[model samples]
Target: MAYLKERHLFPGGNTSKGFYSFYKYILSQEDGNRILCMKGSPGSGKSYFMKKIGAHFAAKGYTIEYHHCSSDNNSLDAVVIKELKLAILDGTAPHMVDPIHPGAVDEVLNMGEALDMDALFLNKKEIMEVQKKISKTFERAYRYFAAAKDIHDDWSSLNAESISTDKISTVTESLKEEIFHTQKSGYGADRHLFATAFTPNGIVTFAEDLVFGFENKFILNGGPGFGKTEIFKKIGSTAQRKGYFVEYMHDPLIPERIEHLLIPELSTCVLTTNEISQTSFTGKVYNIEDFCKADVIAANKEEVAYCSKIFYDLIEKGLSLITDAHTIHDELETFYISAMNFDVANDIFDKVVKKFEKFE
Candidate 1:
């Protein structure tokens, strides 16, 4: 689709085409995702273009939703913007619609009105200068995938006797590189951390160590109850309060629950189940390389490597590693109570205790 330059999109040449080209560039992405930040004079057509693009996507069988960034005086961040986009695309409940963050709402509502927005209208010379800046700033940082008319068509092309591990690795690496580049543009000197809720159990403690231990990595592990998620929320909220940008990666396959609690804020407290193909601290089976990426709440690199190897062994053996640890702990407690079984239980527990005790 042709990009709607300011002069072309509006009647009479007044506003510059700076944001328009940027919007067009976003639309050109393989995922059909775009987050346009409109800044112009009062009558410069911010709302007009917003409506136009939203309608265009809807007509193309894409989901569309409009958000008033100034409503409720919230700060607009990438997390909120992306969630809004996803909510529109997914047709989520109306209650799921989020207000601007309390911290940002006042500023947005006030600044939004004071700016002419229409003041961006410019002559051809100004438009040219703006376009030049846009071209220079936005390099082709993304690699485009072959577009498919439909999802089925895309899957059909991938039908093979067997999927090659090498191809999957290549695609994963390329996607990670793309994400790294995109984040580099938005991230600041201050690093942010996010976690699930803190259960009174050691889950909360584990999460804190993981976050404080890793520089840029995230640690995600599902627990049997809501405790873990609760701690994650507090950590996420704390990070946001400390001026850190956070983005939650929601589990796609599970129904939304406590994870939704942090949604309106756009903090990274939401979590989705890990992919079996990816390395995750959760039960999902992962390769050694995937395990290496985990922030295992360990003190040193040696512990990290050991825990990863242990996780791989457990996954390969089809053992529930987490459950096994808990079960063994319970057994240890029970053995201590039963005078008769103490002999056997003590022997079995001694070896396992020795393994994890070093971490303490």
Candidate 2:
């Protein structure tokens, strides 16, 4: 990867050396995949560069999906919540980046109507005046989402116009209460156990403990506040230290990195929560089918194979995988193992499983 430091990935590609560095670094990865963010003033070639890169990737037979945020559509959060609701309602998870995630297309279509209602009945100045009002209204819209889960619990009593705003608030509060109120649903007892540890100074600096290599694929499971997020950040920092390119996706939308990394047949990895699985149809929420299906599938294949090897034994013997949180998260675990030699793989595998038996 250091070999890329002096080379440029683009000529006349853009107006900045950052773009050149980005191109080369992304190319240095095993799959030469990356997520690149192009942010600049409106006329500073952001769009032009995106188009150029998109086309370049397309010419190489890599898939591309693009979405531009603007005033008319639902905001990113609204999209995530809306699609999450739809998935639960329909019992089919949608990709995080779906149009449905942004509330029905009707909502987007209705925006024109809503804006017209604001405009035709009011002056241009009035519309501008309500801009803040609209923003404030959305802040409360998330409340409606919280309440919506049980809006029809008493279906026979339902009437859209008959229900008062206060009633909505009451119902929303009831639903919100369930998140913290534990119940013996068998889920709590059967829940997966995961462990995580971090130094107070933080692993963001990449100074946390390092496993020389990894040996299997694993899932990192823990409830909120148990330090799962910190573990993820540490993995990113560590991978970067190993001289491998890294891309982080914290967004609900299809990551922009995929566009840049896989263009012209780029291979890339996407990391996020399992909740992401709910929104992506064709395994993606937004219509970014290309990212989900592109050749060189995203996942830890070696660890997956290794895990599959011992899975049945563990199930029959009632054993578990014992290792640090980072060694088990399916994504990082595979990469760590892949970077190791054969002897290291065997030792780590045995150590991880032996410790897993004593994790309780």
**Best prediction by lDDT:** 1
For model 1, the local distance difference test gives 0.26
lDDT of each: 0.26, 0.23
238-271 per-residue lDDT for model 2 (tens digits): 3344333443322111111111110000122222
Off by over 4 Å in 1: 1-52, 55-215, 245-360
Decoy 2 TM-score against native: 0.25
User: What tens-digit string does per-residue lDDT give for candidate 1 at 289-316?
Assistant: 2323233322234533444454334233
Quick one: how many clashes does candidate 2 have?
30
RMSD of 1: 28.8
Please count the clashing residue pairs in each candidate, in the order shown: 35, 30
